[model samples]
Target: MHIIQFEGSSIIPISILTTIASSLVGWIQVKRYSELSASYILTAHEIGVIKEQASYVSSESDFSSFIRDAETAFSREHTQWIARRVANRKPK
Candidate 1:
């Protein structure tokens, strides 16, 4: 760790406070990362399920309908991602 400049002799409390703030920031980042990872995993799992359902369609019309629904779901997910990104940006 770098030596922090203390104007007077009150270095102990400042150093402890700095450490606590850094730890809190790190914890927040880890929580956000886990949440994002879960989101991606869930989206991928949904795609797999959609594919399985689409595979069971015996007619072209049914397959087309399934594809349309999958596209709509993907679009909605994209929109949600964009909204989240924007909201996060606004705070920062």
Candidate 2:
């Protein structure tokens, strides 16, 4: 709607172009930041859960198993976070 407001081939002022450019830049930055923030929150919660699970171990064998499982989980989470970070970068 706003773009179509400039229907005719008239000479549009520079201020409108600047305003549109600024708005688009702000929107893109905010979207990327919010996505990164959400992924961080999710990863933090997952790591917290792993820590709580580790706290419940009672025997040596169980503790060893817990450590192995937690290590794998932590690694998986880290990999996924990295993937998300890489995927979030836009070409434009």
Candidate with maximal lDDT = 1
Residue 24 displacement in candidate 2 (angstroms):
0.7
> What is the C-alpha lDDT profile of model 1 across 28-89, one tens digit per residue?
99998997888788889889889889768999998898988799779877987998788689
Off by over 4 Å in 1: 1-12, 90-92
For model 1, what is the C-alpha lDDT against the true structure? 0.82
Alpha-carbon runs more than 4 Å astray in model 2: 1-8, 84-92
Q: Candidate 1, clashing residue pairs?
A: none
Q: What lDDT is reached at residue 63 by model 2?
A: 92
Error of 1 at 67 (Å): 1.2
CA lDDT of each prediction against the hidden true structure: 0.82, 0.81
RMSD of each: 3.7, 4.9
TM-score of each: 0.72, 0.67
Best by TM-score: 1
TM-score of 1: 0.72
TM-score of 2: 0.67
